[model samples]
Target: MSESVVADFVGHFFAAGVRGEPPTGRIVLSQRRLVLAADEVKETIPLSSVFDVKVGQVPAEMEGYFNDTITIAYRVDDERRVAAVEGSDTNIDRFGTVLFKVLLNGTTALVRHPARLGGRVTDADAEKASLKLEHGSLTFKRKSGPFTVDLGTVISVERADRDLGNGPHPVVTFRHIEDGTAATSEVGIDSARKTNLLGRYIRLRYADVQEELADVSLDEEELEVLVALYSAGEGVSLSAVVDIDPQPLTLLLNGLAEKGIVVDTETGTKLTAKGRVVVGQRLESVNT
Candidate 1:
């Protein structure tokens, strides 16, 4: 309660035995806890005790009553409990973001935004930034602005090396799409523990996106074409690269295009951003 407040909002808190009548109250989020105070009720949930925080969804028990909601799952005295709060869409989203940062505060990293673009290394300067993770995004908060990477648009994340102020350090590099162009960013966490934690969370989200493509099967030839386009960048001759006839390569490209994996551009046939994600996973699996 004494810690600095991260976010404060007027919202509705849902608890058991309320029978669709939740309490309208002040929702307070601090560095260490979340406090919901109403006229007749006050509930405090410690940040450390929270095991999961979900945004844009309410528990089944509290559904229909609230649409824009954040559900907090925590434990108290060895008992698991769930609480839901309803607020404006923006406030609910802000609460989820703030909660994620509060739980992982003090995680600093050297960030290079647009470290690479379209398979080419960039000259962007590396700077110190605070890390903030959400379900769909990874953000680096710098004085200039927050550089956010949309997980849905991510093509690949890999371990790499970068010189961040000192000597060469291990860093997590992400390749994704920005403004319809392939882009990359790098983050060198200050410690091993922080790097591992951040990587784990990011890969979990990446896995979810990968899972959605599970049903789309690709044969060896198709896979070859994808990998070729990924490696060759744009203006790749699919027929020559895959050792297939031009007619068959046209069919293959059409198939991939239909699957939303590749597209023809002004330069040539290229892997769509999603196509890069697909090939990146396949390549990672092969390399490891």
Candidate 2:
């Protein structure tokens, strides 16, 4: 082939291989193997099927070494073929480049610059300027400047129309992110709904309740557990619930104990009289 033709062929080959397609021809160099696929590989490999690809040679019987062959180590590019056979311990810069390529290729939504702020979200001015959404976590930038809202801190994120110096800044408001009792009651009402409904009464109810509860709340997770406890007839063991880790649960329980919402007696957790009343009142308010 001419030089130009050869270069073009190589480019096609590289692209094909990177996309997991079978190439018209194969290239093998010593222990290295490259297969160009004839067809295009799907966008992303299933996360579950991703396994480490062993590259280079290793001593026989070394852990995670394939057949004890000691060569240049590399991992599988099962997820992102760009670095499918990248060397082990790849430099951070190179890894970042490959990761970016993978993300682009996969067309994933990545947050380049997440919002950084915190505190209560409200119709009032002070909270609005501090509003942000960082990595799906709700935050508010303080009037003083940038500040990170702690994960456990309760905040409101109201969605309003882009202000154009017009009337009532288009309030199509809803709760942005809420945890604790608010989240719990919302989840409960959602769960209690029957499948057959004429309209979206339950969902509308949920939206309204969410907005209301957002106004008055505590730690999101604690409220969630409390709601769960109430739903389970005023008590649930720490082991039964999924999604929440134990350390947070311990902290939440302690917080509730201090607030008199939960009593940690030797018999296990039961809502204090005040706790029951608080939970009931919250539930009633949300439902209304």
Task: Tell me, by TM-score, which candidate is best.
Answer: 1
What tens-digit string does per-residue lDDT give for candidate 1 at 76-175?
8879888899888788877766777776666778888888776678888898898777667877899889878878777677887778667899888877
lDDT of 2: 0.34
User: Which 10 successive residues of model 1 have the least lDDT summed?
Assistant: 192-201
TM-score of each: 0.55, 0.24
What lDDT does model 1 reach?
0.77
Quote the positional error of residue 287 for candidate 1 in Å: 2.4
